[model samples]
Target chain A: MIERRIQSGVGPKTGHKNEKGVGCLNIIVCIKQVPSTSNVEVDPVTGVLRRDGIKSKMNPYDLFALEQAFLLREQYGGTVAALSMGPNQAMDVLYEALYMGADSAVLASDRRFAGADVLATSYTLAQCVRKMGKYDLIVCGKQTTDGDTGQVGPEMAEWLEIPHACNAISIESFSEGAFTVKVNMDHSIYTLKIEAPCLITVDKDVNTPRLPSYLRRKRAGNAQISVWSMDDLADQAESHYGLSGSPTQVERIFPPEAHDDRECFKGSGEELADRLYSLLRQKKRI
Target chain B: MAHIEVNQKKVTPEIAERLSSVCPFGALVVGEKGLSIESGCRLCGLCLKADKDGVLTLVKDEPTVEVVKSSSRGIAVLAECMGNQVHPITLELLGKALEMAAPTGQPVFVVVIGWKVSSAVESLRCYGADKIYVYDDRSLEHFEPLRYASCVEDFVRKVRPSVVMAGATSMGRSVAPRIAARFRTGITADCTGLALREDGDLVQTRPAFGGNIMAQIVTPRTRPQLCTVRYRVFDAAQKREGPTSQVEVMEEPDGLEKAGACILEVLAKPKEPDISEAEVIVAVGRGVKDEAGLHLVRKLADILGAQLACTRPMVENGWFDPRRQIGLSGRTVKPKLIITIGVSGAVQFAAGMDKSEFIISINNDPEASIFNISHLGLVGDLYEVLPAFIEKVGREEPVR
Candidate 1:
């Protein structure tokens, strides 16, 4: 129930030539709450992951990304806004971000958002960012620890109409209005430039995240967090948002059953090797 | 460019010039190539063809040429094979490299950097490497992307094997791209398949466009045809006859002296129940509904001794943790039994566990495409089948 306000109507834009050092660069980092990897347990009866009493944590990668955002804010004046979209409980990860030095946090939580896939998720997130208004740079982890597809960043970029740099190697230089980054492509490194209001994904190498500071942790530990539901966003369209908006859906789920159960590859190493050689030869691979 | 009429219409540019006093459309009334539409032809679909190419597509009642980007070059494959564990994909790459190299008759050499001089030398033979280059030093135990990159770059400078195959494990993912940066080469990641084209170029293929599209990528300009493939993409080559291994160890520490090992040492942690090894996998994704649903799925998996897993999205939502998530971002699993319920099969996840022995799928939608790769697909609710499966297996077990 704490009152949240955007400090200033418009902030100084970092990494842009026009605004050098006059005001703070309002920054937002998107984070997700995920199941705790450290204490993952499988249910014995149904072979499903046990999540009833399992703990949740800030995504493993988002911490590094938020740390990078905080460092950028420290070097240049800025406010780090950690935002997320999930159920009501997603506030926990948001709090973790706030504890790490985020100036503000937003949780777009609602029942309508359930079963939303990446494309819809990105659209919902883009709407939230638009709600956040003007900012300098947007930092996100290269990919969520769980969804490893890495489509959300590009999808968000497409929605925001901004350039997205994936797997950034280094930000050679960033000023109030200008930025230079050596981005890691599949194989090649591309040195790219985008004047303020750009999006970049941070990898483990961007910057090591710090443990929560005493002052910030103390304040955030008791901070009254704000949660917004789907109806909260004004002019929220239902045609293409959340699960209803997702074009792709999970068709089925099943366990793999072996076609040929010829498990025996009997013999010693040399003999087995010869027999394998024959099998591979029969397969026309050798 | 001039276009002539097809079928029946006939009017030459010379005839059009003579008849210019009558024609209203600006372009030449007729030419040799095909029909020339003038200003009046506002892309209206007056003319169309149903040929296989179907170059012309009717969009909004107008003929718009269907411009498509051909499924061109396969992605680059950065094969990583430089360590003590002797990465499985290293042989997968050799099989791939040999296949790719056969057309070009290019030699294959590997790069190795570990603590032991003798062991690193011997490991290459079992790996089927033509010539193994070694940079032995106690300093090179852990994988420091920056330093390890320089060492690999040093090897690239000498051996320069086309399609440098390295194991795309955690170490390879870190160092391969950095070294690729040094060579200004392209690196395709976790390629499940690789081939050399008739033109003697290495063709790398990996999942792209959100696991729905399988993209084939290739590097046209780079020298050491770089690639990085995941461990289980291809089956490891079977051990060959006695010592078919031709191995060579490189001695020049040269520029590597500056690339001092910032790494102290790498300690292999005790292995856990790797998601990749689960004989029976019951993976749940975002579709699992709620916390109660997650518990239900777990109850079913427990009865089967099956490992519980989730999609990346499910993990992001705190439905499951990283250790229990299966996909490109987590561990790649190829269990003997894989049962997916309410999970859409994405390429990233499929690549990791596509080699599973038998795949059974359960989803409400009959068109749910996981059935395409599944052995037995049931079109129904997971809630119904999961509990029944657990009961069937339970009843089958002896009273002991």
Candidate 2:
């Protein structure tokens, strides 16, 4: 067992994250495929995307980040490489990006890449980004819908030795290589400028994503998609990907077990309203 | 399926417990039970992979934080759009902001179209907006962010508001960070509630680190506090008689710069479950067991005519659609009737599905927090409880 602790000052410094985006900006965005829902109804028998006619889609927030990238392209005219770590099907988002106007896309798909945790994910993505060449800017959603782990983007930036903002709301500019932007942290607004190749994870409100033009959508669907497996990304210790590489493992799954005396108050408006108010007050959810 | 973070070092159980306290899941026990696997884990598996010595295992764990927040100034809601075809959240924000504002001196002001815009600014008066700042313009049609930010900046400068409220809509969200940055203010995303502090500070509360933890943050320094409320978290402001009009309008952004940020195309969402508006939801996680069990719940849903939703597992296993899953990775639901079967109320999973009108939880764990929020807590296996429910309902009951 390794005994360690985060230094008191090890947390992100209180300053602008985009302070250095003043130079020629090179950016790479790492994305992932996540279960859009935590309530993913699984088959006790076979774990699979139930096509029993049920449906699913990409995480909505990721699309907004992609949209922000497209807008950035319109502004700075830089290369936007969409990097995602997932199964072969994860290409759906990559292709979606291409259709929306990404310069290129890379798929980190491999058996070994399966079940990688945030640390492993960031490690693998940093390596993949290194392989994808250089960039001044990197973007992603604050957190994937399923994984809900907002650590990857910041973790990736830390591993890559670049500054990062975990909750970026607006990107003011990306000039010279220094990127200037704003973030919502704790309760303060931070206007920061950082050197390029920095990482940013934005919320869905960052931008209204443009619908994929039918033409580009078709082109991306037909483009020669590049798939990079664990072997393809890096020849690291086999303990680096999936369950073997991951430190945390999901031991078991169970539904929430609770027995609140959730007795409903059925009555007239005043009574119900009183009941509702008391309930909210009791739960402290008001 | 766990994604554990390796801080390049291991943390002591004490610190782990502290981090866990601030974490969405419950505190780490350090060794033994907390090590191998947790007791209240939602099966997110993110923290699990953060280590390698098998220090942390993904089990059903408790959410470190609470969903609601507290502050001195009460809830600071930034109401963006609230006229014509107003989103229910707009009024809900108004009602909540009014409630939160009443206890404190924080006035709930509604931000409308910037100067010279055509949105119905007058209609907002009925919803509890103490003052209105309408920044209007043609570019504001689709909520041009640049213009929105510029307008908010102007309003914040003039008002010096204790808390600047905004909806978590695409427009409000984009505008929030930029505005907050302009003032160097701290902004919380998709917050479910807001409150004030004894020191007259705003506590911006929302689900943090995913749905596992609900956190309350305060801007101890920045002025004109900011908070972005998640949609549908509160009830709409009931309309009042006479007039809900006669409000104020704000100055528009600089013309040329505002017109420059163009929106090439904006498409409305076209889908089902519209999880955003569902009044009745039956969210199922691992408690429903496997895909076959999901079918049973679906049958029950069909019998009750309720939308069937799942947790992350069903999607990971391809047993359900990602859209239908509830939690941090999924949609937030505040249904009228939310029946849980076998689902452990992990904080992340609980964050998105906790706001139901009537919550009925069916899990074997007698101490699960789901009972804390359930309208009716059933301490038994869902398999046993569900059949009885189906019989009672007879068939799926539509909203006839």
Candidate 3:
């Protein structure tokens, strides 16, 4: 188990400061591995998602988030670390992150952290961040395709007692300890500035993710990727890490009832509209 | 927080082995000391159920006792708004709350947090709220996530309502979870349906695991059962003239202006016609080739006096305004007539428009999933079918 310490002094290795006099930034991009296809099945008895034969890939939204982190790292001299919480196989996404541009990777994997809901998942991620070391900023995808809650990043920010913004369209400006961003809030986009040690969940389709370099893949094949279990985290309580920590209870999950009743009308456009208008009239909708 | 206790003296190696299999979350570990409860323990009592000998007991964690203060009555609705006017979804939530309130013999309360919302009180009362709590402050003119969350959290802590409902809008999504986190309570987000059980539990039904299934979630032990209902999921509350709801002005929290982030500016997005309220809507999907195809869609909509909408991809491609997009994440429209052109109905898109009174889907792909929900399915090229439909409709009904 790796012990986490919050270093107070600046290290000689990254003593370079920006023009605004801020120390070298340490950015952590949180990613998750999700089933590639949407055809996942759930066990009715256990109420757990099944992933036996399904292939996994880095969450599609996280790609934009990593792209944003890479851009920030390029503009400012900083070290970017890829962090994730999942099973051992999640290292595949971490390895991909290494080939892309992340300086390092860490996976918080343990059997004890399984079946976590949004709250427990965010708490586990918050503990993982605390263990990974000091970070100036944390980046995450707007939401995971599998979970689709869009709540983890903000919840993690809450757990860490930091500020966070969701659906960020672009980083408008950045100084030493703060950055201004444009956030898309459905109807309106608001420009907001958040201080360092904050989190931002990037909107998908806003950035073009870079391709993994084959040269880097070959050279960094043996890159040291830290793997941490529950023992490694700051919060070692088993109850706070998994299903027990979750407050919501799922009584049942069943396939949505499908209605197969439909009518096929093969005719010219005029006949179709005539039929449609008559049908609406019959239903008294018009 | 949860409390799990095991009678170590009664636990045998076999019992420890059996305990590991009981927690689907793997919260129980079969250590050398027999069995130990982990942080992941939900206090579900499933382990006790599996162990017939009653060697285990699960209880609420005592350390966080203040979080469970006192159970209060009434159903509270978080009134969301666009400037001074209340959003329709808030009324929809109030409508559902009133329905649940009817059987429970509980009053309905509306909580409005904004500046200069006195004009909204009459509407809230008309919508069946027995009381209206308004938190009026200048700092709240624009949404700051944490500040808004803290204010609502303080209000909830003070009132201790049995249930709290919010619209699943962007602001609602941001605020509801924070309040839930503050209270350490369970929140069912984007719920499509809600019900009050005989035991006064709120059963929140929502699509889970990527819309593959609808899961019925319940906050059985938690007070102020929090839920965010999707817009248009429930009918709006009817307005009736009667005794006005009691109005109480709430003071803003002490640190309301000291949140971590600052809103640099609040620029209003371009005003577009709301398709959600349109009587007839003509929507196109990814199958449309380019701007020319979109022109045809526009012409058809013009002839039919319908609003133009599209599937999510069109919005992602910058072809349509997000306001004109129809899907689970976008606006839910239940128009009288909806014509989907070249749209293969994905489940996400179907969830938004399934309730349309009549749907006519025209696509070259006969096996398009949109056909399943469409009342009139035309299997042909939209390029061919759209122009023909426009010309026919124009000829049949000349402009007055």
Candidate 4:
């Protein structure tokens, strides 16, 4: 049996300095471009995804993150700079962010950054964030629809040596260089006050993201979007940006097997209900 | 490091076209000098496998850093405690770890970290762990990511385990990547399959691209390969009678009390058991339409003593709690009986509950994909079928 010891006065303290010391908040919202449709199919013979006419769109979850940033900036008098790391085509999402009220945009486009796993992807994003300059908050979507790995935001926080919180359902308040956020952890919800220079990944439906304004798009004609590659970043090592920097390797990729043998019954609602109820009784599943 | 090397002698125009078309990411380019691999090459080796005449081969180079393969040993599982009882997923992972460790003769260890978790630690003894590490402290009651991750880091440094696994619960997903980043190793999330290679490498298989494809990942050059497995993906370890296991109480690490974020309040949701643990579930999707439609489904669930679950759209529409959502992005459940209403079975949604022992899906659309994986498919309106089903169940003998 182990003895239990109690500690006294172990709660959170106030009056921490706003690390950046900026009068207003400077936010960076990380966004991504994912395949517009989830029904991507693979060719049987070649075993490759048929990507001929698949359109791209901003990850739906990132829209909520962008809305959160825009809302924060509206209340707190700050600038929201949208950042994305992908091919040059990714700049379209950055421009969409601008039309959605972002002050500026930055795209980290480089051939060397391809084939990055979570670790390498986060490292490259962190390097890009550092190059973009001072920011009090970095917001990201809960996860990308394609990758569906919620690890990138936290891993980026780790690389920057800052604290991070995921599944943020709401941002309650901000004062004294700390933001009180309500995080949804499956079984419970926690309200935490984190100091500045931290990262957060917001959950879906946190807010109804505002649509891109046609007027704003016309006014922002020929808006310059900064593009940074390996040479522009602080870390120029080829091993740290792409596949070589990634620790995990994809051993195989194949289409998931589908269940083909199934029974189907089509009839009126009353007939189907009776059939299902009787089937349930026969199977002992009631 | 490794790369794709294209042989010039064997490359004809026809072969070059085939090779270029074989790469999924469009990494192979039929350039003026023949086929060349570009930066988009993911080292997936598909082109090499497609090359019948040896036009392409993967070349490996000596690693820059020496891999100390002998320093690490054993598999460690991070056991989670919910209100003094060990979470079932922890036992599932331990069972998996034991199976993987049997071939290598590696020891199995379980790490429990929380406040006053002695009961949880003791409960794990019967699960067949060789040793248990406990970090029970008052300040560690509510999960602070920094503190929890620090404790895990200390354990990893001390034990030097070759592999670490945790459940893909909220807490596990939050802390696992941070620990992996601390060790600068690879961490796979939401892995549905895990196996150990003869060389002791852990291979993780997970669905990607919205469950359209499955990817097998491995950490070739990292130690303590980390992964988070979803609940019900593996069987729980059976408790042994009169089990003998060494219990080691870990000392609190330095600065354990100082966390970057301070918890202001912790609100435990009402005592609804997790959907994954339910024996019977009635799941709804966008086809349920309005609040009135949802009410009828709920009534059916109540009649059958089944829990309520939903697809991703229902959660996004704010019709149900995110916890109840089932898909690749949400929880994975393998209940004994699952009944889906007005659900178009997308691959992502099917990935979560297709393993249920009995599945019955009702949709108005005759061609909905939900019918493919379902054992009993009913093509009818949910609003009409739900009430009729409720009436039939109510008129019959009470559900057992």
lDDT (C-alpha, whole model) for all candidates: 0.56, 0.57, 0.76, 0.82
Ranking by lDDT: 4, 3, 2, 1
Which candidate model has the greater lDDT, 3 or 4? 4
lDDT of 4 by residue, B132-194 (tens): 999988778988777788788889989999999988887888889888777778899888889
Candidate 4 CA-lDDT value: 0.82
The fnat scores of all predictions, in order, read 0.01, 0.07, 0.43, 0.62
Tens digit of lDDT per residue, candidate 3, span B47-143?
6657877778765443322344235677899988667788889889988998998988887889998888878765677767888988888878777
Native contact fraction (fnat) of model 3: 0.43
lDDT of 3 at B370: 80
Best candidate (score: lDDT): 4
Q: What range of 10 consecutive residues in model 3 chain B has the weakest lDDT sum?
A: B61-70
lDDT of 3 by residue, A147-192 (tens): 6667778777766667778889997666767779999885788999
**Which candidate should be chosen as best, given DockQ against the real structure?**
4
Docking class of 4: acceptable
Clashes of each: 70, 122, 10, 0
What DockQ, on C-alphas, does every prediction get? 0.03, 0.07, 0.30, 0.42
lDDT of 1 at B3: 21
B309-342: candidate 2 lDDT, tens digit per residue: 8777767677777668786656778887776777
* Model 1 misplaced stretches (Cα beyond 4 Å): A1-67, A71-140, A143-286, B1-83, B99-105, B255-257, B264-271, B290-292
